[model samples]
Target: MPQWDIAVPTRPGRLPGTTMAGFSDRANTFVDVEVIPHPGVTVVFDLGDLPLVIDDGNGQERRGPVVAGLAPNRVRGQGQPGSFACLQVRMSPVVAHAVLGAASEVSGAVLDLDDLWGRDALRTQERLRAATSWEDRFTVAEAALARRHDAGRAVDPEVAFSWARMVDSRGQLRIDRLAAEVGWSRKRLWSRFRSQIGVTPKRAAQLIRFDHAAHLLAAGHTPAAVAADSGYADQSHLHRDVTTFTGSTPAQVARAPFLAVDDVAWPARR
Candidate 1:
């Protein structure tokens, strides 16, 4: 397998544990394959214009933009042998609202990158291809986002950054404290968070907790130990959240080796 280059941008003063890059290649193919799985919210660039295939093992194949948002638990697809490269901006769900330009409570796995770009898909793809470095690609994506913001379609950065901090803490932090830290009233904080991030602050916290618990379980930790480590109230509480988020018990997840490594969690299930 050829090793494709994966680059994570280093933006000044960004939150921790928010970005990553990995490259994978099929044994029989020549194209360098890369996967950039982001958090609950992210921006994928120029994926719509790529020639790719998604296989779900159901005897069906889907093309580019195989999945976006929070609908599907996983998005698996392939890009052209050498034509697919992307820079993903993984943000908390709140940051997503700023870039997506809508407050539509986006969720479920929907693969339609082309639809997101609309008429500019081809141009964006070309620009991505023309770039010789990841930095160049980042510049293009940033400019595109800036244009959208200038058009009166932007989410409040402070709110988005706050939400990122909240989720990063995995519900360990309290909303009241969070609001006070950010100098906003509880009501105002919740309002902006829900509008931009799609889920209430409480729900987002739960999801982050669920994600951490799931990762520990998948990594072979005992349920009781995982519960303690993940800040769950008890083993039963951990089990409940695991079932609610993934429809399975800790033991079940532990038994599935593939699930352990697959990228599919809130902060990204890698």
Candidate 2:
């Protein structure tokens, strides 16, 4: 199997954050566990017909469409890690709107995989088998997305940068401050943000906070300090967010050996 390297691509358009791509070589063990420690959303590309099973704490197993925008704390189960080679496109909520069309508002922690993939998802996977390079794979995926009924509008660079700053701040900053910095009113900011990014400012803030905390926890930080430093009211607040978004405690996550990937780390409080 090929070693996986997480690559953060330059922000595109108004998209401010980076895109992380993880690809495994043919001989490696299959990847079974995928713990999403970020609050934004994902657009996945399956490069092979290998079955991709997702169990988000739900009893039934699902396999289908590429997921669009899933809120924080969503857990997905992939059957045996080595079974497939995949590409995951990670983006902040603002960047998500560029591909998902409208700013999304659904609040469920786990989205149904069937709702996103449909039958066409299988066809896409089949076509990906012929792809030779990452760029080719992305091209195939983009072409498939273009055929979707609701692929959403592409985001501009300015909006993406604003969203990045907000997410990177972890909800510590106020919307008015953000608006002022961007030269827009609170109302105008909210309106444009909702239309383009989906979710309200408050919800987006929550996701950002969760993501910031996750970054810290993954890096080997203690939960107590992570909470205090990440601006949570206390350790309990951090625990609640972790439980709500990741379905696990800080201790549980910290002890998990498979999650030791490089991008997965606990961020030290600044």
Candidate 3:
């Protein structure tokens, strides 16, 4: 993988469910990067001379600050011919629901930040661009998220508890059992979780499981071993999930740049 300047938060954010990374491609060379699916909401603030371009692999593209909802499939960054700097934020869907307002708007979609925050998006870019360093930029971004989260409507506690359980078990627990534990009927839990988290509970579980398996693959584990460890029925099941989520085989995904930089950019996960 090609090296880019990556910056992490100097300290944990005030918010519990958010992680920050700063990235800059200062080479002024042509660049293209594939973006794999992940189980959270992604917000990117552009502070470059030219805007960052995101291609959805279907002839559609968006530039400038953008938000991608859970499990956005087959997306990539096509860097313009210039240096680019941006602060990228990953939010747990529980927090995303409050921070981004209507989380369903971003679920499985890529949208302009302006659509969500309007004038505030531009103001945020200016603030981040004026910051002296990556650490400062992370501070600005976190403050903005904290403000929105404080004012926005929150998801039900039952739904939040369900998501927490899924993450705790690496998505191996049964959803029906989760509902029982959360003190909600399976029907109510499913409805509330889908409306707030953007994806159905089962889909969220699959995404979390797929993320774990992908990282294991990137760590040099074989497909058979990754499948067994990640709770798939078998190697073939893992292969299908990998192909479905990333449009790539397990072998190819193991070498993906998207997964390759997770450790450098988000060390806390390691």
Candidate 4:
């Protein structure tokens, strides 16, 4: 897929991972695409009055401006309609926990923004819609995120440290070693990490690794090579992970309409 194949491509240049630009529902016109799980949390602020849907196979398909804390390998939001417009922020789990005031138990789940922030969600949407220009809208979104970040409690230091290490290693590190380095027993680390970050350390690592592999596939690499480079024990092991996380084979994910626009809409630091 070409870099800007969507109906409305991301603006020129890029924003930090914590930041994302708004686009009209005209931005993408793709259809019947399932959004696969990624490592970060996605907080979408819907400016348009149209509805949004999230399907995770639990009989719950949410609609409209939602704050989702996705767990490893879960799918959400089948296809967004063209009438929605808003800023969609993709953030590290640390920043996500603070701004969304999310609990780990809600991971792999999608909740309407109203459910999380109550009237603030409605108020913020109204404020964004009232803005006269994109700059003003972005400013309002940033300010709201800053307010929440400052007000919400942070995750445990050890949990943060382990998560950071896992990211740094591209999810190649051993969970036991990570626990040992943080001076916590395996059980303690598992409990705290799951409670705070939504997914267990092992699962989190697998998700991170799959993300790496998926991008490689999108970049035109063969699955065997991607699997090896992504630290899979073998090619079939790699296939299982890709299938588990995406419900698609490597080839299908590579051709996914959703991923065809990611490098532009959500460029990763790696």
List where candidate 1 sits over 4 angstroms from the true fold.
1-5, 10-22, 26-39, 45-50, 54-62, 65-67, 70-87, 109-111, 132-139, 149-158, 161-165, 175-191, 218-220, 251-270
* RMSD versus native structure for model 4: 3.6
TM-score top scorer:
3
Which one wins on lDDT?
3
**lDDT, model 3:** 0.87
TM-score of each: 0.66, 0.71, 0.96, 0.86
Any runs in candidate 4 off by more than 4 Å, and if so which?
1-17, 25-32, 72-84
For candidate 4, what is the TM-score? 0.86
RMSD of each: 5.6, 5.2, 1.4, 3.6
Ranked candidates (TM-score, high to low): 3, 4, 2, 1
Instruction: Point out the worst 10-residue segment of candidate 1 by lDDT.
Output: 30-39
- Steric clashes per prediction: 12, 30, 0, 3
Please report, in order, the local distance difference test score of every candidate based on alpha carbons. 0.56, 0.59, 0.87, 0.73
Tens digit per residue, CA lDDT, model 3, 125-230: 8899999999889888998889889998999999898888898888899998998998888899988999999999999999999999999999999999999999
Better of 1 and 2 by lDDT: 2
Give the higher-lDDT candidate: 1 or 4: 4
Write down the lDDT that model 4 would get. 0.73
Candidate 4: clashing pairs of residues: 8-27, 54-77, 71-108
* Per-residue accuracy of model 2 over 146-265 as CA lDDT, tens digit each: 455245556555556567677668777788788888888788778777666766676677667876777677678999888988889999988887787667888876754445553532
- For candidate 4, lDDT tens digit of each residue in 144-193? 87788789888999998998898889999998999999999999999999
